[model samples]
Target: MRKITAGFFHSVDGVVESPNLWQFDAFDDELGALLGETMSKIDTVLLGRVGFEEWAGYWPNAEADQDFAQFINNMPKYVASRTRSQADLSIWQNSTLIEGDVIEFARELKAREGGEIAVMGGISLARQLFFAGLLEELTLITHPVVAGKGKRMFEATDPVTRLELKRSSTTSKGNVVSVYGLKPE
Candidate 1:
């Protein structure tokens, strides 16, 4: 079975939205290497509606030399959007509109033979998969700064998701890198 993984750029105060606004200054060589390694193993991408719209607008036109352009552009992208039609997804190459339940699609995809599947930039979708027990692992590259206000990854009413820390490390610039495995309930 293929592993479903998601990597989030997090803050000390638990913010997850718009990491580029706060995380650029903190990005270091080690972080670059880590991200490169993660991208290397992922052959499929899973995204939510918002992420699909946002990325589809830019990534396709991104320069070939851009770090992630080639990989993300060419990967098989499965988008979960209740509102988007096949025509909307046709704007980007290799993008497919998920026809039914996202969780069920993920379950079937994981059981299929493939390389790693990475959930890209969809906090809502990632949360759903995480709570539904479809996500096998999560990597958090936590920066030292506290984002004053923004949407967070977890909320009060969310189900308690247990994560077993598989490995952790701190970068020279104070970013905390941690990989966690989902613990079955």
Candidate 2:
């Protein structure tokens, strides 16, 4: 079975939104290596509607040497969106709008042969996949800063989900890189 993983650049205060706004100062070689390692294993990319729209606008036109530009731009992207149709995804190349149940589509995708399905930065989509038991791994690079305000990864009302820490390390810049697997029910 193909492994499904979601990675987030999170803050100490739990904010996962727009890490670029607050995370660049703390970015270092260690973080870059960590991200490269993660990208090495992933072939498919999954995105939520918001993330899809946001990324489609920028990554396509990004300079050739820009980080992740070539990889993300050329790789097949499956976007999970309830409101978007197939016609709407033409703005970006190699993007397919998932039809019907997102969870079911993911399951089918997992069953097929692939390298890895990566959930890039879709908070809502990642939460849904993680809670639905579709995501096999969750990796977080927690920077040593408190973003005063932004959308968080989890809500208080969300059902409790347990994770087993597969591995962890602190970067030179005080960023904590942690990899977790869902605890067996």
In the range 48-111, model 2's lDDT, one tens digit per residue, is 9999999988888997547699889888999998889988999999999988899999999999
The candidate maximizing TM-score is 2
Error of 2 at 110 (Å): 0.4
Task: Tell how far residue 112 is off in model 1, in angstroms.
Answer: 1.1
Question: CA shift at 142, candidate 2, in angstroms?
Answer: 0.4
lDDT of each: 0.90, 0.91
- Give residue 118's lDDT in candidate 2 (0 to 100): 98
